[model samples]
Target: MNLFELVEQLFEQYGYLVLLIGLPLDFIALPIPPGNSTLTYTGFLTYKGIVEMVPAFGSAFIGAAIGLTITYILGYKLGMPLIERYGKWLFIKPSLVEKTQVYYNKYGNKLLIICFFIPGVRQFIGCFIGMIRVPYRTVWIYGYTGVAAWVISFFSIGYIFGEQWQYILNVVEHYLKVIFICLACSFLILLVWNRVKREKAKKLSNATRNE
Candidate 1:
């Protein structure tokens, strides 16, 4: 069966436990159900009264935290050796890790919050953070909150849309591409604007000195 069908079967049989277990596994990059679709489906169930809302949300949040924590710890304990040995399989190069570390260092833990929203990014971010030795407290504060917000948002969409919840998956997938494009354009604009400002300032300074 397809992933959504499999997820539906699991949830129908196991309910909250499935979410509690499944979410973390997905976060850890397991080839299980997609986390977003699962969470949204749970929310739809909650609206139908098949599952309680609080427990569903709580289970998802906890599952995500547990999964991320495990990955982070693994990254911390194993360090570069693990990456060097198996990173190629995951397509993670040492150069990419170095670049991620540099960006994380410059931007601080806020990137951890933003990473959760990016598909294919959330899976690796925890490991990278842990490998870089970010404080556990910082990870808990930023990482957990981000996961919580992400879970709640998607779940809420499912709950609000009720029987139409399936549409959310398509909407999310489409919007994500649009959001990424917008972000890229914004970043480029800011970079060019900053360069132009600096050049203007330098030219003005030179003119003053010459006068």
Candidate 2:
């Protein structure tokens, strides 16, 4: 069977346990079924009376939290040394990690909320925050809220659309790609603007000193 068929079969057999266990595994970057697909499928199942709503939602939320928490803890304990050693395998470069740290420093933990809606970003935000040594309380507050909101929004899309939930997944993934592209462009623009501003300031300082 195909991946969707396999996921559906697993959910059929394992019910809430599949969600509870599977979501965290996804968050931890394991190669299980995609979490979005799983949540959407679970929501669809709820619409069909195959699974209860509350339990399904709870499992997704709790499982995501567990996974994110573990990633954060690992990042905190391991820090740059770990990333420097193994990050390349995950496509996590030191420069990317440094850029994330800079953004975190500027925006504080609130950025974590926005990160949730971004696909690849959500997976690494916890680890980046942990590596930066953000306080656990802040991480829990923003990170957990982000997870809850993200889970509910995606799950609701599936629940509402019923049989058409797969289309919603495609649309979301498309938008996430667009968002990342826009973010990359914006970051480049900001970098150029900052460099120009610094160069102008340096010239002015030097000219004034000579006067």
Candidate 3:
């Protein structure tokens, strides 16, 4: 059967447990039924009263956290040795890891906030951050924030649109990356502008004090 059909059946049979298990699996790149569709479908189920909204969100968030922690721990404990030993089988290469390192270096931890919105990046992000030795505290803060945003966005779509959820999801998937990039740029610009304004104010205050 198709993924959508599979997800529907799973949800029908298991309810909130589907999200509890499925989301974590997705984070580890298993994606048995896929994250986006699964989340949206969960929202739909909530709307239909097949599952309670609070528990559904809880299941999704906790599941994602578990998955992220698992992958991060794997990367942290094993480091490059694990990758070198099994990279070929997983299609992961040292070169790919090096490139990810460069990207992480350039972007810093802020990437964790938006990585889930991006496709392939989300699957490997926890491990990548751990491999590069970013502290778990930083990952926990930014990564969990991203997880909440991701779950809310897709789930709300399903809840809000009802029968139109699938159509809306298709459109969103097409433009998700571009939309997030624009938002990230705008946030950075605002941060820079605020910093400049603060610095100027500090300088003016110092000059007045000297006078």
Q: What's model 3's lDDT at 133?
A: 76
Report the Cα lDDT for candidate 1: 0.81
Tens digits of lDDT, candidate 2, 1-211: 9987787788778877887788778777773887777778778888888779998899899988988898899889987888799989999888877876776678756767877777677777777788988889987789999899889988888899998999888998798889888977987898789779999999999999999
Model 2 misplaced stretches (Cα beyond 4 Å)? 83-100
Clashes of each: 0, 0, 0
TM-score ranking, best first: 2, 1, 3
Query: Higher TM-score: candidate 1 or 3?
Result: 1
Instruction: Write one digit per residue (lDDT tens) for candidate 1, span 1-211.
Output: 9876676678778877887788778778872777878888888888888778888899899888888898899888886887789989999887767865765677757767867776777787777788878889999899998898889888998899998888877787688778767866875686588679999999999999999
lDDT (10s digit) by residue, model 3, range 16-35? 78888888889889887778
| Native-to-model Cα distance after best TM-score fit, residue 161 in candidate 1, in Å | 0.9
lDDT of 2: 0.82
Name the weakest run of 10 consecutive residues (lDDT summed) in model 1: 99-108
